[model samples]
Target: MTIHTTSSCTAFEGVRRIASGALRDVAAAVKRAHDRAGGEPILVFDDATSSPIEFDLRGGVDDVLARLADAAANGAGAAGQDDEPAAARSRGRPKLGVIAREVTLLPRHWEWLNAQPGGASVALRKLVDAARLARADNERVRLAQEAVYRFMTAMGGNLPDYEEATRALYANDRARFEQMIAGWPGDIREHAAKLAAAAFCEVT
Candidate 1:
């Protein structure tokens, strides 16, 4: 199994966003900025999730690149073929970390579930998977909105029309949000727009 990790990150020096891209790329940019002015505080945030990214900053850009490559290789090698006995694996669920918990349901509901082709567990899993698929788009939009809100709260709280911009953001009013943030500093406005891009696109 191949494990994929997020690639997007943004580096900010004070309120100015210096770079935005893959983790390694942003790390490189941060190094350059740090070299130009020693001791200036720099922060890197995951662009998609609006969370801080921490990495070893003791070395140079080349070191950071090597570490990133090593991480990628390790992730790929982490999940190899399982060597457990087939019969033992088949005896119960495939060690998917399933937990047994008591659930209370009406007699009619239990009856309906028990009558399903694969019984209750399989039927419930299928139903859940189907529901997740159906709601995938909405879930994506909601998460994007939440990420944007988090970034805005951390970085743009003091900007003009902050409250109105937040209201428009939650209201899914793209035009209004854009108008409200029009007077913001270029860097802040651009970063906020980038964070909210997906959420705003879902407004239609």
Candidate 2:
């Protein structure tokens, strides 16, 4: 999408009033002319500093379109326009190689996780991946929580009641909840801890 910007001046009035959806190149050129003459483009929205669309005014329609095509392909902006800063560059979906924030599990939590079929490291990764997938699907954190309940129902799991565990955690009595969970089956205990950690943030 070629976003063209132009000054709100009388000389470039024709550029500003171009046919809807057409003449973006002319608009861009006019804006460039205005900029060269030392005026800033007027943003249409009260909340926006710049137009949602940007335009490049370096040449004729074909030339501008060619440039726009190239930019669209390569994700570049206008010729003299500043490249997005490092902070603003990473927009859209999260990157695969980026480091995610770390959440520390208590010793008992680790012990519980270790008792799972895949052990602590694998289990934690699985939990994180599951949470990410749920978030992507727009699943409510509470709704995504059915996984914890399911895990608890498995054989040799420690948790006797998913609702009670969630209630204690939601109430902020972490110590009491952890104590209640310590005696459950190992897998249930591990799963509850994961749920608690995930739900804790949503609740607060």
What TM-score against the true fold does each predicted structure earn?
A: 0.66, 0.25
Per-residue lDDT over 9-71 for candidate 2, one digit per residue giving the tens place of the 0 to 100 score: 111221132222233444455555544654544322101111234456465656666776676
Backbone clashes in candidate 1 total 0
Local distance difference test values of all predictions, in order = 0.80, 0.49
Q: Which stretches of candidate 2 lie over 4 Å from their true place?
A: 1-140, 155-163, 169-173, 202-204
User: Ten consecutive residues with minimal summed lDDT in candidate 1?
Assistant: 1-10
Question: Per-residue lDDT for 62-114 in model 1, tens only?
Answer: 98777777777887676655678777655645576877889799999899999
Model 2 residue 29 lDDT?
A: 50
Worst 10 residues of 2 by lDDT: 42-51
The TM-score, computed over Cα atoms with residue i paired to residue i, of candidate 1 is: 0.66
- Top candidate when judged by lDDT against the true structure: 1
